[model samples]
Target: MVEERADAGLYGPDSVTWRIHGNQSMALAGFRALSLQAVHPLVMAGFNDNTVWFDDMWGRLQRTGDWVATVTYGTTAEAEKAGRVLRRIHAALPPGVEPESGLPYRVDDPELLRWVHVTETESFLSTYRRCGGILRPGEGDQYVDEMRASAELVGLERHTVPASEADIEDYYAYVRPQLRVSQVARRNTLKFMLPPMPRWVRLGTPARPAWAGMVGLGLAMLPPWARRLYGLPGLPTTDLLATANGYAVRRVLSTVPLVITSNPAYGRALRRTRGPVAA
Candidate 1:
């Protein structure tokens, strides 16, 4: 029997979490996740309060990506440690009320976390399938099931999160009536589309066009209803073009060596877990 090492982390190398989160496409799909999450006024309000200036935009996201990387690829202990750090940070944030609804909010609230979690995994699955990553038959559902481990890490009750695409769609149905772009959400959308870049890159390189195009494609990959919610034209034609572009982007990214593309924590985990599993 090919037994996985005891220290293979929460989901191990064979997991859907690793496959999705480890991909370069996840970086591209991140805008979709953030865009969808911001439809909730409270979620958007929380993000609005934490807006990073200048290059800090990417810096903050990089820190988040590192946390995800550690959670996905670190040893079980390491993964739990990363989760504790996040919970502590979330706990420390002051609670606020949404101005319009007067609904008080906490970032660590389980319901809010569930919304974030579902939208995030939806974005990942959509990107994976549309960007040429294969999903055979029931594996999509399996992917959803496996991600409960992550939900548990982020202070969510695993049973409360969606465990399949159908469940995700149903949750969206319930939340759809409440979804709208508040002023905060609108600002969140704009910044996500135009993240800060160093002056030289902005002026000299094709950075603005390149980055905007990628963000646009990410937005296009969202469900038609979601794209419409953002006031973007969600024509099937747009999806056709975006899918082609995303496929090309994924292919190009795949050419870069794993060592170059994967985060250092992931690299170390692979080294620790590869080959010769002791029962």
Candidate 2:
């Protein structure tokens, strides 16, 4: 348990960053971000060459979540420490060439890092708004502007990350030609959506399907253009259907008791700012 302190960290309780990242819909947004990230060939190549995601998928997800939560809600010192560690790790990873582009890349490549940041920021904000979480006028841009700090943490140039919805859309349009659903992309993307389960659990219980259903809600969170890049046939009512299901999923997940669902870093920050706010 984190005791009370005066520090409010990078984004305080009153920030739009907190307003969005603190929402339950963030779980869904994470899955959506992964799927979106895989669309970039260089990103797929980086993951394929540098990570052991296939061998320890659950650990990969947990680490990703922990890093994001720490940087978002940990004390300023803690957040900066996490950033330094990430930079060191990225710097040590060996470089590789993307198969499609025949170009060498680093995990710390500014362009690739920018892509990851924009996609995640877009995914989180879009999920929060789409799933019925409220944001006052222009908070969307504020959230995007705020995320530039996170982008910097992951080795992106502070000025390079998109800072508004229009800039983000422009970035997507510029990068669209480079996005495609390759065989490797498909394989890696499926790993996030359908995680490995024990044989007995798969056969005897609804666990896999139930979990997949939640991930499906994340897929539905994808932008229509992304779905098209993945070759989804745009049915007339898919958006309507998906939006309804997204509302249900958000409501259910939101109802999980705070004691059970609170992120540790967020809980600590709450105590620091508001004196034992988390149960």
Candidate 3:
């Protein structure tokens, strides 16, 4: 077992990642990242073969959100434990076969792991910036640098992962030739993301509009290449509209009560940072 530390897991309160990820608006970033990841055939193969995400999207989302929250805000021991569990799970899974290439893929494959890390980090940082999360000059790159340790925990090589914003952009450019929309990607984009509203949030209700707007914002936040892959508009005007919508949502969510927005893991980290309360 990893030893517990009083300090925050990987990023302290002052870190750019903590500030960017703590905002509720980053939820859209996660959505955008998933869409981006799905374009990789090998990644989709791994998800299709090993997970029930297609059948239970909400459950997958909740589990993913919990893992991200824990790693981002849990103490050192907690984060290491989570990492170990993930590594073990990945190791135990059978090799996935890419439908197009007929080549076997492993969950712990360094290249595949690098793809996941790059897409997620790029999406999160881009969305956070677009949503008005403030970052000092070079802090965005610093966030990428800081995430190297997190990526290593999940079987990515530090040297293979992008270490700066420019590196991320170049990596995406280099990998663009290998990315294309697959049937699985299309199904996930349409079903999980913009599914018909549940009966509970009936049409014409106040909650319906908010729910619809959130889904729309998620679609709009997809990168241009991803949008094109999904047959969505990639015009500059569309980009502008998406940016405006994301900013609006960010502004509104920023006002949400802290008690409602803050996760339990974050609370524990805060307590650790501030030390125990006096009787």
lDDT of 3 by residue, 215-265 (tens): 667777877877887788988888888888888888887788878876767
- Assess candidate 1 and give its lDDT: 0.82
lDDT-wise, the better of 1 and 2 is 2
Best by TM-score: 2
lDDT by residue for model 2 (1-279), tens: 765547788889989998788888888789889888988888889989988987898898899999989889988888889999999998999999888778788898888888888999999998888789998899999999998988878878778889899999999999998888778888776775677888999999998988788777677668888888777645647767777777787888778898877677777777788865444
Q: List the residue pairs that clash in candidate 1.
A: none
List runs of model 1 lying over 4 Å from the truth: 1-6, 50-55, 257-259, 275-279
TM-score of 1: 0.91
Worst 10 residues of 2 by lDDT: 231-240
Every model's TM-score: 0.91, 0.92, 0.90
Give the candidates in order of TM-score, highest first: 2, 1, 3
Worst 10 residues of 3 by lDDT: 188-197
Per-candidate Cα lDDT values, in order, are 0.82, 0.84, 0.81
